[model samples]
Target: MTTVVKHATIYTGTEKIEDGYLRFDQQIQAVGPMADYHPLVSDDQVFDLAGQTIVPGFIDVHSHGGYGFDAMDGNADEIDQMVQKMTANEGVTSYFATTMTQSHENIAHAMVGIKKAATKNPVIQGIHLEGPFVSPLFKGAQPEKYIEGPDLKAFEHWNELAGGMIKLVTYAPENANCAAFERYCLAHGIVLSVGHSNATRAQMKQSLATHVTHLYNAQRELKHREPGVTGHALLEDNIYTEIIADSFHVYADMIKLAYQLKGADKMELVTDSMRAKGMPEGVSELGGQKVIVQDQQARLENGHLAGSVLQFPNAFRNIIKFTGCSIADAVKMASGNQAREFNLTQKGTLEVGKDADLNVLDSELNLVQTFSFGRSFNPENN
Candidate 1:
């Protein structure tokens, strides 16, 4: 049966429809002003939203794990549970199971487990390989001992183990033999993202990478004279930068500054959250290093900023607050940008014939409910 949602403000990623209606079942069938809406049958599932707001489902391309489970644990059942929590609590209908820099064996194991979980859970869209080829100079929470230079052969092995599920990779451009690595990734439909690097401006300018991971954190900082990785990301219009807008990872003013530079089209809002998220503040571990979670921040023993505990819904709300951008623009940052960058054709915008992945929000932009592949769930009760 078709589902109809009416009397809502809809952000279709490409446009906004005030007092509109949406029709869908696994895929969106129609979207338009309320005057244009016509129910297909008497028994269709119709939801009178009472003037709520609807936007495309949020897509997180750089999340590790959450709800007390780490993706690196290599447990398919636990990963499934973690993804369920992600959908229920954060309105993330699609996610990338980001992996950490670890031993080859451990990384391989994680790839296998993520592949297994993804087989049963379509929400596990792809894998973001974030390690083993990054620079030690900016290894924030990544384990340094396992950091290696770019190696295409090793990456090919891991991707094979993942059944070709790896879609994005975070690496330092300054690493040796990076050109070949970047070439291989580009040829095979993988996006190369610069992160955890200390690359100088000249080095970064030579790179073909089109994405930036957790911008301004664990990477070369912007210097008036040097204009390193951070500056490069801001200057290049083709590069999509991921920002953790949790206020702790990036100050609100700085987020606004980035928004001014990159605009909504080139910036993506990612949680980058870890296992400690959704758990009470206490001692935890990330990438085999002891971590302390307090004050809404997660940090390593040496006081380095670990992955965030920020929820996706909070990040969605924070981006609008920090940038003062319109909800339509924020929707682009939260979902539209990632879909365009990663080529997730079925997952992003709310329009005719697209996947029925979307979220219902109150006036204040709080996620009230999520509909993933035509299945609805209330976030509050989850």
Candidate 2:
């Protein structure tokens, strides 16, 4: 059966169309002005948006977990529940399951479970191996004991254990063994993101990698004399940077500055949310460390920023609030930019022939409806 969604202002990520209509079933068949309207069949379902905003389903390139479930917990049931409870309700149809700094054995164990859980789960696309190969100097919420430099053999073994589901790997370029590991990642079709490091400006320049993880939080500052990772991230136009935008991770001024410098094209808004998300304030766990969620932030017991309780919808709204950017530009940062980053060519943007993964928002930017795998579900009711 085909569905025609009409009477909405649609932001195709890069462009906007007023009074548009979208025809899709699993994949978008056509999308344009209502003037192009023609029913595929008499039985085709039609949805009247009544002047709402329609955008692609938000894609989170980096996330830990949500709804009281931690991705690193290695629980298949939790993954299943998260898929239905978190993403379906929050309009995040796709995401990466991010891991944290832990022992080699523990990290491998999480990968093993994530691999099995991702077999057919629509929400989890790939694994983001965030640590055990990072610098201790900048290991924010990661356990210090488990921190180490680039270990190619261990990484390869973990990748194998993960059933080759690892897509993004974050590491410090200051390590001695990084070149070989980077080579492995590139050759294996993995995205190597620089993060959790105290790398100098010269070292940052040498990295020339494509992605920077959690900009400014686990990273150093942009000093006049020393420069550093943050400086290069601000200056370089090629590398895409991740922004928490939760307002707690990075200051509001910094967020505005970054947006001013990078704009939506180079900025990818991520949640970096943890198990405490979608849960009431209290104690939680992340990478075996106890976390406290209060005042809308998640932090380790020792006062380090653990992760976050932010969901993608709130991140989408917060980005607009922080940057004062257009909903179209914020949509790009939240969805299209990440889609282009990971080659999810069919997954982002509300365009003809793309996947019919999209969300509908009311006038206030509240998620009202979601279409994932071509089925419409009320986000609030879900």
Candidate 3:
């Protein structure tokens, strides 16, 4: 029955501790220096946190809904109210219910209501889909009569009605069923990525799919001698790329040139937010068109853009003020490189054992208290 938490400064995606101390109940049993934590008994629940900073709980493997709610809103209670409004207002201890481009019976009815609201919401950690097999000349807001081309038997009949929970997919690796959709996402391990593309970096390195969907907006730009697929998403060093630092989708100097060309363990920070995220701009709606969030972007009144009203403490403080980096490399691109490219080994990093997915920030990163797997949250009493 631990819980501890002491004076914190933490950031353990790699290192940074400062008067730390951690502990936890559902997992992470220990963490460092608060003079090496004591209080092992006497109703252990502690919590000092007088300096507040912690990290870890942020992972958004490409979102598609938020407060006004729309994971296609096929409704499994509006995808569990967009997973309790993204873990009580975007501290999001996990995400990825994406789904856009509609109609294949509304993307298999929003992946059978996002696989039954991800089995009753453990922060809905699966489905991404983002297409009717993408790329109608960089289909940014994805809807050109619901585009479609790639098919692997209609993605294994909507991955057998979402029972497979569809991990990820954003086609256009040269879709014409690009080699049977890369042999059905490498024989069902899923996660293909590449984005509404105009592929050609040799058909995006011939569909081996190293991942890259929101790197340079809808994809395909880095041209010099025709270095396309956004130049293998910025000179591929095994591309992972997906940064949407939100200041109107990737600016702050191209999010500091994609974190200096994919660094924080190959960059992951995503918030392709929609449902006009936490609402309140003007009008909203995503794949069914009609969006217009004004000042924070999210366009599509024939203007395009359309997917971002970003949260996750403002994309983790705009990736630590647009890549001056640190805060443990912006929590390793907002949650340890998407939990190591979705293997999700007990979700991202904190140290000791794992799972007590974290949060709690102050040195301007904002979100002051959230935790997920061990269940305590408080975006001002959400």
Best by TM-score: 1
Candidate 3 lDDT for residue 251: 73
lDDT of 2 by residue, 98-168 (tens): 98888777788888878777775766777889987788889899889888888899999999998888889
Model 1 spans > 4 angstroms off: 380-382
Order of the predicted models by lDDT, top scorer first:
1, 2, 3
Off by over 4 Å in 3: 3-15, 18-20, 25-32, 40-93, 98-102, 106-108, 125-129, 136-194, 199-221, 225-240, 243-266, 269-331, 334-355, 358-372, 375-382
Per-residue error at 102 for model 2, in Å?
1.2
Q: Please provide, for model 1 over 1-382, each residue's C-alpha lDDT reduced to its tens digit, 9 standing for 90 to 100.
A: 6789999999999999889998888888889999998767643789999769999999999988888999999999999999988887888998999999999999999999999999878999999999889999999999989999987888999999999999999999998889889989999899999999999989988999999999999999999899999999999999999999999999999999999999999999999999899999999989888989999999998999999999998998999898899998999998999899888999889978788999999988888889998888787554
The digit string of per-residue lDDT tens for model 3 on 1-382 reads: 6688888888778788888888887778888878877777643677888778888898888888878878787698887877776886668888878888877888888888888888887777788887877778888788888788886787798889988878888888777658867877878888788888888898888788888888888877887788888778778888888878876776788779778876778888888888777778988887767988888888888898888888878887878787788778778888888888878888889877788889888767788778787778787444
Let me know the TM-score candidate 1 reaches against the reference structure: 0.98
TM-score, per-candidate, Cα-based: 0.98, 0.96, 0.37
**Per-structure clash totals for the candidates:** 0, 0, 0
Ranking by TM-score: 1, 2, 3
